[model samples]
Target: AGITGTILILGHTDPLFLRELLEYRITQTVIDKAHGIQLDAAAAQAGQIPEVHLKIDSGMHRLGIDTRQPEDAAAMFALENLNITGIYTHLAATDSIAGEDIAYTRRQIDAFNGLLRTLQGMNIQIPLTHMQNSYGLLNYPDVCCDSVRIGASLYGMGSKEPHKSNVIIDLRPVLSLRARIVMIRTLEKGECFGYGMMFRADRKSRIAILPLGYVEGLPRKLACGRGTALVHGRRVPFAGLVCMDQLALDVTDVPDAKPGDTVTLIGRDGEEEIGIVDVAEAAETLHVEILCRIGQRVATVVIDE
Candidate 1:
């Protein structure tokens, strides 16, 4: 775990969290507003000067100082307690090639560049500058800077659908979700199963119970045959309502499926692969949301390959 790369926190700053960051030697963080500047000043008064990157609100309207008021950010360079190492902005809609969205992203880039020129006119030299998030880097590679802030793309995921973006990278997924089949049983043709008996077997069927459900971030929307899992290298449909900690998969087609078999919920099995995007599609949400909602109870194993 000796990763010595710079670990910059991209979230907004607060006084209490800033103190904790300083205490842990994580001296670099993003300053999105005047309040964040004050927090850094207080830390300086306490004998710690945290390196910070000023974030300009280049049309995201979510965080960062306003682009119109470059003076507000220029004033921060005077504060000895805050070492302004970098400056950046977030591009709101760089993911879409739609005419309006493209124009909007161009405007954001222009605004951010305008701010940088203003700061340069004041003779303020920031060591690093960047504005590209994952989508921005992919779609607007010409808008380059010292570094880029990539999130989803780092995990081998970019667009919800490949057709939505102009640039596509052959990225291999670095994460997988798997569950063990705890039990397997046969359901009679007329039998109902799960909460509210939402699923009834129309044929004599074999089902495998997995110790994973909504509590584990498996969307309930996938219940009642709407979702599938890979068992013995074949697809198996969800057979009943997904419970708090359990769900049943119709494994009748995979006659070799049995208790203790591995279920690929979001990963590969033999020639079959269930990507995170596939899970997100079935759950009617974004793949990033699916990745973020994975419960803490689920174990994460990092494979070095």
Candidate 2:
């Protein structure tokens, strides 16, 4: 937690947001999306500009000026009353080692580096430059100039499927999602469960109702028997459709499960662990998406042991 670097604000911000940033004295910002005109207007309204980092479009085609276009790049960099403290870009892909996206990532880094050299030759010095994302930092550490942005890796999600990385850094996932079983009951054979009565009890079934649902960021497919949770250190299958505020789980196998018992949705429970990647795979989505879908209503309880 002993972080001692500037927190860069990425993307264009509204003038009001910029004013708030000024009021808070948070001035280290990146002007990655603004052209000369937008920067002038926003910075004028926000008062004195902070240390600015120019964003260059090396290849992503999203934000940043094309440094290859000399006239355009020069015009933006030469704008008055604004300080250009650094230059940066975003890598499109660094998760691949053999695809065109990987090759394009290298090309983008090359172009950005070349632009830096050009700027140096022209006596325009940028104090900092950062182009690497989490994947880029792991795969292309040498090219990660000035600084590296660690996004997913900061949360121990550094790679895609298989959830493995060759990076030298040691990472341990620390986030976990937990819920409580609010109700437990026994269902007779042939009894229906949940909306549309999608799941039918084949035998005497012990079920547990959890006060968690898609609204709380649990994947809806779980209710369709796609995902599993751990209770009493045993695996349990989800039953029927996930409702707006509750989900049912087949806990017949988890003989010890009961009301108020803890459930591990995406976390470790004894020897069993359900990771973000695991949930993503079950939901047919990305790990980042799974993480972001977590609703704001859920309280974040941190454990630092």
lDDT winner among the candidates?
Answer: 1
TM-score of each: 0.93, 0.88
Model 2 clashing residue pairs (backbone): none
Q: Indicate which candidate wins on TM-score.
A: 1
CA lDDT of every candidate: 0.83, 0.77
Question: What is the overall TM-score of model 1 with all chains considered together?
Answer: 0.93
lDDT of 1 by residue, 122-146 (tens): 9988669988888888888899699
The superposed Cα distance between candidate 1 and the true structure at residue 79, in angstroms, equals 1.8
Candidate 1 segments whose C-alpha is farther than 4 A from its true place = 27-32, 159-162
RMSD of 1: 1.9
The lDDT, on a scale of 0 to 1, for candidate 1 is: 0.83
Q: Write the per-residue lDDT of candidate 2 for residues 31-101, one digit (tens) a residue.
A: 44354456556777666775567788898888777867655556656676567777788888787666676
